[model samples]
Target chain A: MTPLLECRSVTKRFGGLAAVDDVSCVVEEGSVTAVIGPNGAGKTTFFNCVSSIYPATSGEVRFEGVDVTRLAPHVVTRLGIARTFQNIRLFRGMSALENVITARHCRTKAGVVASLLRLPSQRREEAESEAIARELLAFVGVAKWADSAAGSLPYGDQRRLEIARALATEPSLLLLDEPAAGMNPRESQDLVELIRRISKRGLTVLLIEHHMKVVMGISTHIVVLDHGVKIADGTPEAVRNDSKVIEAYLGKEDVT
Target chain B: MRDRIVRLLVATLAAFLLALPVASLRGNSSTGFTIVWTPAFVTAAMVLVGGAILFAAVEAQRRGTAFWDARAATDSAVGRRRPCAAQAWTLGVLVATVAALPLLGLPGAWTKLLLETMVFATIAVGLQITIGMAGLLVLGHAAFWAVGAYTFGLLTVHQGWNFWIAFPAAGVAAALTGLVIGLPALRLRGDYLAVVTLGFGEAVRWVIKNEQDVTGGDANLPGNIVPGSFRKPMGALGEWLWQPAAVDGRTFEPGTVQALIDRECYWFALVLLVVCVACVHLLAKSRVGRALFALREDETAAKCMGIDTTRVKLVAFMASALWAGLAGVVPAVHRGSINPEMFDFNTSVLFVAMVVLGGLGSITGSIVGAALLWMLPALLANWFPEVQEYRYLFFGALMAAMMVVRPEGLFGGARRKGAA
Candidate 1:
């Protein structure tokens, strides 16, 4: 099957420093792909390039054979790619349900006049959006806090809510940036199950994770990066034993 | 301790500034036998009251409390949901009181004051859509108001058009102008947007002033906008409601005709206010409203959620300007004239002040703010007409004080803190 997402020679430069240099990768349909690296490994930059948050300095990004390298972030999202931020950027003052319902922006077709008039079709769309948002919030286990402000939720639930919000977009490929970052061990274990369950839902998952256990425990395919360069790519077991992957994590001589 | 001292100093300085006019006028009176004591006592009273507020604010800040938690008080007083039986009862009572006030033999001036407040309340409700809900700070609202008023005034005077026909036409004209400004202005955010909009207001006034033939220049159009009688077919309802009687060479009842017309105008304005409030309230509860709130909270995150931020912002601008446009017709309809001066920067600032004071994003808050501010001057005009002249200065001081003490406004919405 054709890859769901393909990044060819993607490079992002920031004033003399190449944040993501000559990086190329493919996310196959319905597969769980993990991109792991050290602190400055360009994992987030690579994601940014693909999501069109930052246009790649060189190279192309194709989603299901359609070139979307230069598309705006919202346009990219409309093309079935949704992502969570590394810093948990929920609409702070909004309720959890609102945060999720807001993601249905592209899916819902109600305009200002229709909404103002409370047209039957608009009301139906709104009710449906609300129902879907509530279901997603429940799926993430923060359904009880649906009416509470998103920022006021506990840290773990906030992360879950972000995931639920991303899921609300109904994207084909979901990109999670450090989904397990700052999460406790138990939470990370739960996140692993969640990712597995999400992939089982027939959606392709691409995630950047620092928790080795979560990465090794869930990802079907692994690609490693170090200093803006791709160091390894294979199945979890093969990538785990690769010399360069080991060298990238630890010093070369120390690994030897 | 330091904060208290700073507050004390600021309060004293404000008192001095506020008293400067009174003090300067005291000795400058050409007639040396002026009643200076009344002015002096009023100034002192204002200073003392202002000092008390400053001290209280300082105490609240020191105690690490929500210094501006008026939202709780207001929420309790006017319950958020309108459909609640108690709220509905209260609303019915309020509406009845307003409707009956003119018939109760109240002074004509007071009725005029109430009508003015309703007009401003309507305008503020429109402004709340953009500034309060959409998280946009538009300073050119008065320009749209001016455009509507001019359009209405011109069409009525020159073309001999009826009031009903000219009203919607004026609104559309202003909306077109709003589109013209909004397309370019929406690209800039926060202060830049404010500055550009401010420029738009001045630009509009300048254009009107230069277009001497059409707009009548700075002298203003005269009293030609004679309000046409709301005629209905001779039927039982019309006979019962508006029975024409011959008295003192007039077809309608002697003194009651003018009073009835005034009452009719009041009713017309009231209906418009209710419609504006209902529409704005409904819009705020809709999907577009939620999208606006999301965009206001975080543009980038909203974008990642697939919101077209530009389209949203532009829509907000146009909608807001549309309200101002509709409101612009009121003054022309009421006063029967239009002038470039009527749409000054001070008018724009007053609308912003109303939004900020009422609580941004809260519909009732905007209405209350506009009503309170408009009524304040009307009530005080008989006693201190001089104070009415310095309205903008007072508004500026009030806004500054609000920023320090109650930045979230009276009925707090989202804590709008970020500059961008």
Candidate 2:
């Protein structure tokens, strides 16, 4: 099968330094992939380029083999790719359930007129969206926080809420940027298992992580970048043994 | 359990307000300044009682007092609290009391007062779009009103155009002017936009003043709305309009022009009021409305969310300008003259005050706020002329007290249920 997402010869520059320099990679269908690099490694910038959150400097991004490099984030979302931010950008004032339910706008077909008229179709869609929001929040294991303000949740729960919101978009591909960051070791372990479960559900997943263990253990394929250049790509075992991959990890293969 | 006390406080306040005109019977009507003390009693009673209750509520919650039972700090109680039956009852009672306005006092001026309230409400709705939903400060709403008045004045006086077409034409003209103002909004934020719009309002006034040939400068536009319309009172315009209108030879001196204008405007204002309210209701729930709220929350995030911020901003600007345009025509028909002096800095400020005092982002609040501010001055003049000159002083004092006490207008926002 064709890859679910592909970036070819992608390059991003900020005046002098290339944040993502002519890198190319394909996220295979129904697989969990991780992009890992230390600080200033361009992984997040690469993610932004593919996610359409920022315009790519050059190159093409294909979502399920359709070119989508120039689409706006919401349009890109309509093409079945969604993402969670590193710092957890939940709608701060809205409730946990509302944060996820808003993503249902991507799927809603009922117009404002229909909603105002209280049409049966609009009512049905609203009911369905609410149900899905609740179920997704539960899937992320933060269902108890559904009625609370999203901002009022603990940091760990907030991260889970971000994942819940991303999943509510019903994307064919899901991207998580540092979802495990700042979590304690136990929370990180739980996150790894959750990623495994999400992958098993046949949702193609791409993750950007700084933590070595989560990236190395769960990712079906691993890609590494150093100073905007793609230095390594292959199976976790193959990428781990590459000398440049070792160098990109600051020569700490034992830990990586 | 404690709902009854709040209900009782509201009732007592209404009773005092109804009795205010009796106390004002002692004062003469000509002067521009005086404090109507009977209404002052109502304001003071509200302040003292409301302040005490708020203090008690806050203190009780702090000490975990048993009397203030079940007051959870959980936001469900305050932020997203549903409007209950008590709320519905309060609205019903208020409407009924206002319905009795002419019966108790001000018998002849009931329609006039109601029509004026509705006009301000329309202007306030325009402010709600620009300031409440879009989070843009518009201290210059009167500019749009002026734009409408001039459009109607120029068209009707010079071309002898009927109001049916000129009213909507004026609306579109104001919207275009709003679009011009909206261009600079692309670069400004918060108080900066407010100042620029304020300047724009002054510019509109200046243009009207200098163009005496067109605008008649400071002179009122002689509102020559065809006379036979109200005098007949048999057609569609007078259907639901209160009978025995101001010029229906009820109590007015026979054939007085003021009574004629007043009578005709009663019918015209009623029609416009219904249209204005309905139009605002529709606009509030439209696609543009959703986009406006989203932009207000975070412009960058809204853009990232795939909403076109520029398009939404332009819509809000037009929405505001159009309503003010519609409202501007009311004064022309009411007074029969559109003067450049009518659209000044102070009128714009009053419109802003109506929106803020009502509730930013709330249609109901805007209506109530508009009515309160608009009527405060008039009520002082008619009911208590002794307090007429000092009416604004009382208004200022009341507004300040409200800001401290409730801060969220009389009704707060038009509720958006299930919105997170």
Candidate 3:
């Protein structure tokens, strides 16, 4: 099958710095892809360029066979792409249900007037959205906190909640930026399972993380970046064993 | 709540005295100011005292130290959508009072102080969108209000446009202006944003003041924007209200503008108020709203979430400007005029203060702040005309002191500090 998402020679520059330089990768359907790199390796920036959060200094991003390099984030989201932040970004004052339901906005059919009038159809959609949101929150294991304020949820649940929110968009391609950051060992292990379950739901997951263990544990394929350049791409074992990957991570002396 | 109740009783007693018409209907200055404390006020006072004693007794008997439970931290597995009861009550009463104040309108008092409050409340809600939701410090938000007013004023006066047509146009004009303001804001932040907005607001006011041909400057344009439908018939409600006088001209009659102005402004403001509330509420519950909150909480994190922070910022800027514009159109019709001086820096400052006083990103708080700030001056002046002239000074001072003590106003919530 054709890849669900592809990045061809994506490059981004901030002044003299080539943050994401000459990076290329494909996210296939029904696959869990991981992008791992050390700090300042432009892993996140590469994702941003692909998702059109940043206008690439060069290259193109194709989602579902359309060049989405110039598309806005919301537009990208509309084109079956959803994302979660490395650092949790939820509508802090909102309830967990609201957090999830917000993502459902992409799928909502109500016009501005219909929503304003609180029409019966719109109300029905709102109720249905809430129901779906509850289920999604449960799917991510934070159903108990569905009505809880998003900002007040526990850190690990916050991560789960973010994933649930992204899933709310019903996107085919989910971009998770550092989903494992700040997670405990147990939480990280749970996240691996969560990723597995999420992939089984037919979502093409593309994750950016610095966690080596989690990266290797769940990814079907792995891609490594060094200063925005793709250094290696293969199965987790192959990429993990790549000498370039080791050098990209551990400094030269430690890389023997 | 008890403490607030006691405060309310004290305020009520003061309100009753002030609502009494000074100089009397007879215009006899010699009769002096008679203190007419309505019986309803007596009930309120009783509630106040009873509430205070009951609250004290209850707290004394309770095991806990405070009335409220400590809010859960992010590390806590349990998350609860703890509604702030204080805010709920404030909003409930504020809405109820604003809705009812139109009864005073049927009496032909131009700019029913209550109506004015509702109008400003609308403006404050718009201002709240910027300062509260997007965390944009708009020092000159009133300029948007001016833009709305002028748009409506010029169109209705020159083209004889309908109020409904002009209203939306005014709002669009302000929104476009807001988008323009957002451009400079790309290079500004925090205090710098405040300065720029202030400059922009002052510039708008100056433009209006300087463009004497259009705005009429200090002379102010005479704006009498009548709804084309007003002549279309009021149906049962209109007929009932306009019923010919009974006893004499002194008897209650509804046909006069003085009688209808308060009610009209109240309804017009109420509709817009609901629209503003719903918009803010929906925005807070959408991806767009989330982006705004994220921007406010941490722009870096929002960008990392694949949100273009600049785009979200601009969207909020336009939304806020649009609201101010909607609010501005009302007063022109309400006052039957649009004055350049009305859209000044002081008005902008007042808008920012409302959002700050209400908690930032808290829609309910914004509404409460708008209503409270809007009504206080009128209520005070009605109850105590002697102190009315210095009302703003007191309000400004009170707002400052409140910010110093409780930077959050009466109903401030945990702003952008939500489920994340």
Best by TM-score: 1
Error in Å for residue A135 of model 2: 3.5
List TM-scores for all candidates, in order. Answer: 0.82, 0.74, 0.75
Give the clashing residue pairs of candidate 2, or none. B32-B389, B33-B389, B34-B387, B34-B389, B34-B390, B35-B387, B36-B387, B221-B337, B221-B338, B223-B336
Q: What is the DockQ of candidate 1?
A: 0.42
lDDT of 2 by residue, B1-420 (tens): 454354344334433543343233222223322334445334433543443344335433543543222122111111232233543344344444343333332223544656677788888877788887788888788999999977876776566666677778889999999999998786688999999999999999999887766666765543223333342222443221111223434443523544444555655555565556555554454334545665665564454444556766887898789889978877765655667777899999999898877666666557656767776577767657688888778978978976764465544532233233
Ranking by TM-score: 1, 3, 2
- Residue pairs clashing, model 1: none
TM-score of chain B of each: 0.73, 0.71, 0.71
lDDT of 2: 0.69
Question: Compared to the true structure, candidate 2 yields what TM-score?
Answer: 0.74
Ranking by DockQ: 1, 2, 3
Give me the displacement of residue B346 in model 1, in angstroms: 1.2
**Which ranges in model 1 have alpha carbons more than 4 Å from their true place?**
A254-256, B1-82, B222-261, B386-397, B414-420
lDDT of each: 0.74, 0.69, 0.68
Comparing 1 and 3 on lDDT, the stronger one: 1
True contacts kept of each: 0.61, 0.10, 0.20
Least lDDT summed over 10 consecutive residues: which range in candidate 2 chain B? B69-78
